[model samples]
Target chain A: MSEIINVSAIAKVEKEKIRKRIESFRSNGKATPTLATVLVGEDPGSVYYMDMQKKVLESLGGTMLKLTLTEDVSEQELLSTIGDLNNDDKVHGIMILFPLPKHIDEHKVAMKISPSKDIDGVNPMNIGLLASTSGGIAPCTPSSVVEILKDTLGELKGKHAVIIGRSNIVGKPLIQLLLREHMTVTVCHSRTRDLKEVARSGEVLISAMGRPKMITEEYVGDGAVVIDVGTSELDGKITGDCDLESVMKKASLVTKVPGGVGTLTTTILMRTLVDLYEKSES
Target chain B: MSEIINVSAIAKVEKEKIRKRIESFRSNGKATPTLATVLVGEDPGSVYYMDMQKKVLESLGGTMLKLTLTEDVSEQELLSTIGDLNNDDKVHGIMILFPLPKHIDEHKVAMKISPSKDIDGVNPMNIGLLASTSGGIAPCTPSSVVEILKDTLGELKGKHAVIIGRSNIVGKPLIQLLLREHMTVTVCHSRTRDLKEVARSGEVLISAMGRPKMITEEYVGDGAVVIDVGTSELDGKITGDCDLESVMKKASLVTKVPGGVGTLTTTILMRTLVDLYEKSES
Candidate 1:
């Protein structure tokens, strides 16, 4: 049986560290760090995700200023709201929930977020810094993956890491992070020819392709560390890319779906909020 | 026997296109596009590189504003120079020659360049744009590599491309570019295990690691398209990462060092100048 890694266990320890940091800020008479979250077109998933984040930030002594816009909100209106939050001294970090209405140019809105306040790391400047120098606020999902990998693998140098996916949010940034740790990374996407052969070669394999239960034991190597960043709804439950039971038979360790990368994402967001807050203060 | 690719043949064709574009700009009563090159400390290599670019731009009917600074120039002084160029209306693009000085922070200087005028694509915003959306002005070297690949292969989809080296300028950005072409990309570095084996897996192998003639025939897969982006000085001559004679025995195609990626780099620089100039005009 594979050692099933639960992110809640990791998040528990990280929560303690975040609490202490928040306490330090309070002791220093600094105002609580604030995250201004902009949501357009109330997608149920986005709504649930934001609600979960609100609870997480409150638990850690941070503030989430939720701004809700209708589905028909103008692009200029959304940008204006982002500008307001950007200028507001109370806002320490800013996050714009993904999947905005089709009419709104997502890239334009993303580019508008100040790098200093870009907690989710959607800003091009932050993304570029992550690529060019591996120094910047990385996207929360990718950052969570690195945190989990660090907690699990310790030293990532010289490892052949194969990632299944080429997403801007997860796979791409993760490649940069792993490369920074001196890992040789191979990114296999939909266009990859021999997916199984390439996937099996990784000492460390990460799947973020969002295809539910697509990766099986056949795709895994012996004693490989598997990280599933894929989240899909299958049979009304959150599912990951890996076939857990099948993958367990071959892998040494595999992260659980619902509580794996998803669980730590909130904790990492709070950590980023603290980081942006500190940067603003400095 | 392998076909050796020469960039001059490709550049000759591209130069005609540039010439006509310049003619169109002049016909419309637009002032010639100008590239402001900031050169600090008289490094022979950098000076030579800048002079070549100057000649290339002049050939394309563009202007080169050569800004020379002394060796002992302060960081603030260099940044101030970049700031002035950023605001200059006549300056369509700004390029800072490498190896500024041991004392100056290169990253800081790179960040100071405006993304709009960052012709070499060193600015974090541009880098982020490339990584995130594949919609930014990329670095000249990586852009040159893409030009060669596209010119040689025509369509890059689904091919396995293995790149050696993970420099900010070449490897990282090239991975993004190749990935944008829907090619499965793998990056190897000094820390990569079984470098030759990993390198041999690619149908298209690119060497940007500045180790002179490090890639041998054993590293090249049969009929693999090889692009040598590595340029190092060997016995007072420019050398590439490939053992050309040995690689030629197995590879279907190979690029020459001095006349390979280097020749097209100037054309691409002029191309980027035209792009930035056009953007500024619009």
Candidate 2:
């Protein structure tokens, strides 16, 4: 039986530490560490994510400010709201929930947020900083994967990490993070030829392709560490990028979809809020 | 004999096209495309690069503004200089010559250059923009590699490209460029295990690690296209990252050190200047 990497349990422990730290800061009369989220056109996924973030933050004595906007909100209006949050002394970190309606320019909206306050790492400076290995705050989903791997396998050095996505959000940033850990990283995307052959070669494989059950037994090498970063809905059931049943047989360790990386992201989001807050203080 | 990729000849062809375009614009009484360069503590290498840039720009009827500073220039002084250039209407592009004295923070210096005028693509925004594959304008050296390969191979789609350096200036940005071309890219560095094996895997191999003759015949696969992005002084002679004499025997197509990627860079710089100029106009 494969060792199912307990992502939530690990996140729970980390959350406990954050809770104590937040309390310490609060008792010492420091401004409460706050995460302000801007949501445009309510998405079930986005709502769930925000709910998770709010729960994770408030439970640790941190504050969550959720500003839900209509789908038809003009780009100027959204940018104005973000501008306000950028200057707000009480807002330590700001997250813009994505897919901000077709008419709105998402990249422009992302860039408008100050890099220091961008806990989601949406700002180009944040991604560039991550690429250049200059700063700490990385995009949450990628960081969640890193945290999970760090918990399960102490040191990632020399491991061949093959990521099955080339997204700005996950695969690209994850390469930088894994490279920092001294691991050999390879990124495979939609155009990658002989995908299964490439997938089987990874000592540590991460799938973030956002396809349901795309990775089967053939993709997992014997005793390889597998991380699924993809989440989707199939027939009203949650599905990940990998086939958990088949992957479970050959994988030495694997992260299930809902219970794994998905759970850790909101927790990492909370940690990022605290980090951004502490960074502002320092 | 290996097929020698003539980077200089190709650049000349591209330059001619740019020259005609510039001439047409000049005939219409448009402002001459201008490039402003910031040089600190003039190194011999940097001097040569500047000279080449000047020649390239003028040959195409563009103007070059060269500002030389002393070694002990304060960071504030440099920032002030960049600020002036950023606001200069005549300056369409700015290139900060390498090694900005020991005092000035390089990243800070890079960020100071306005992205619109940053022809070198050193700003985090430019790098971020390149990585996100939104709009073009990549860092010159990396873009030069893509141009050479695109010219030689016609299409990089589905080709396996392996980069031998992880520098922010080279390997990281190159990944985005190649990925944009739909090529499968794998990056290897000093810590990479089975170095020879990794290099051998590249159908299109790029050596940018700045090591002289490090990639021997053992590193070159059967009929691989080798791109050497390294330059070093070995025995009072210019040498590239790969063992040219040896790799030439194995590589189906190869780029020579002096006449290879280096020659194309100045032309690319010129293109970037014109690009920034045109971007401003549009």
Candidate 3:
């Protein structure tokens, strides 16, 4: 049987490190690492992500300021709210939950977030910095994937990594990170022909497509490292992109959903918050 | 014989369109579209590029402002010059020639150019915007590749494109552009194992790694559309990454050095200048 990677244990260790850092900040008479989350309209997914962020930040002895707005919040009002957050010294990091009311322009909102405070890496400057291998932080989900891969496989140089998504949040940033690590990266999406053939080429395969249990045994190459980043609710259960049971039989190692990437994602978010806080101080 | 794309003819046609636009602007009593270029030190290649830019802009009835600084120019001094250009009412666009001395930080220089006037798309904000498929402009080289591909193959959807470089200026941005066009992209670089095998997989192959004629006929798949973006001097003659004479025999369509992507690249730069000028007015 292939080893099922325990991501929760990894997250737990990361949380302990965050807790220690926060404690040190408190002892040193420094302000708590505070994250300001701006949420508009109650899209369940966005709301859920915000709550997870809050729980993780607060649990680490950090502060989370939730600025909840009505679904009909005007673009001006949203921008002004973010402008206020940008000026607020107490807020070290800022994250704006997406899918704001259709009338509001998401791109404009993304730009309004100050780069230093954009812990989620939504700001265009931050995204560009990541792309250029310059000074920008990356979004949490992609960062978690890199962290997991590095932790499992120490030397990634010359390794072939196939990422099965091309999203700005996950797939795109993951490509840059892997390339920086000296690995060959192939990005596949819905339009990709021979998806299974291409997917089988990766020594390390990452699935971020939101399809549940789509990547089955045939997609798995013998002894390949599989990472599942998709989360979808099916029959009152959380399912990942990979059919874990079938994949485990052929894979050397795999990360399960709900407890795998998700657990580590929140931890990375907290880490970014602390890092932003430290940067702000320096 | 494989079809050699007439990039010079295409550039001429585009230049005519630009000339007409400038005439229209002149007829309407508008200021001439002007581009400000910053060049530090006497790097022959950078100087040659600036001269080419000047020649092209002038040919299109546009103004080209050259800002020359010594090799020992400080970071603050260079940024101040950009700031002055940013405030100049006559300057519609800005381009900074790279390799800005070891002492001066290039990334900081990139960030200093205002996004609206960053015609070359050197600003991190623009880079990020392009990556996110948002409102940012792309650099000329990558844009030229897209133009050539779209011109050759009407619909790029489902095409397998393999880019053989990972530079922020070319390979990285090109991935986003191709992905936006619904093509599957695989990026292979120095650390990519089985480089030739990976390169042979592209239905459309693009080489931007400045190694002189490293990609031979073996790297070309049957009837592939090959694009050579690399230009390196070998024995006093400029050469490209692909062994063009051999690749031309195998590729159904190919772009040659000196007269291929480079010609279109300069034309696109002038196009971006006029675009920025129009954008500034609106």
Q: For candidate 3, lDDT tens digit of each residue in B1-282?
A: 688998888888889999999999999999999999989999999999999999999989999999899998889999999999999989999999987899998888888899999987888999898888657888999999999999889999988999999998899889989999989899999999998888888999999999999988889888999999999999999888988888987899999887899989988999999999999999
Every prediction's TM-score for the first chain?
0.98, 0.97, 0.97
- By DockQ: ranked, best first: 1, 3, 2
- Stretches of model 3 off by over 4 angstroms after superposition: none
Q: What is the C-alpha DockQ of each candidate?
A: 0.89, 0.70, 0.85
Per residue, candidate 3 scores C-alpha lDDT tens digits across A1-282 of: 799888888888889999999999999999999999988988999898899888888989999999999999899999999999999999999888887899999888988999999998998899999889656999999999988888889899999899999988999989888988999999999999999988888899999998999999788889999999998888889999999999988899999987899889889999999999999999
Better of 2 and 3 by lDDT: 3
Sorted by lDDT (best first), the order is 1, 3, 2
DockQ of predicted candidate 3: 0.85
Clashing pairs in 2: none
Worst 10 residues of 1 chain A by lDDT: A130-139
CA lDDT, candidate 2, residue B45: 88
The DockQ assigned to candidate 1 is 0.89
| Better TM-score candidate (1, 2) | 2
Tell me how far the alpha carbon of residue B164 in candidate 3 is from the true structure, in angstroms, after superposition.
1.2
Q: B240-269 in candidate 2: lDDT tens per residue?
A: 998888998899999988889998888888
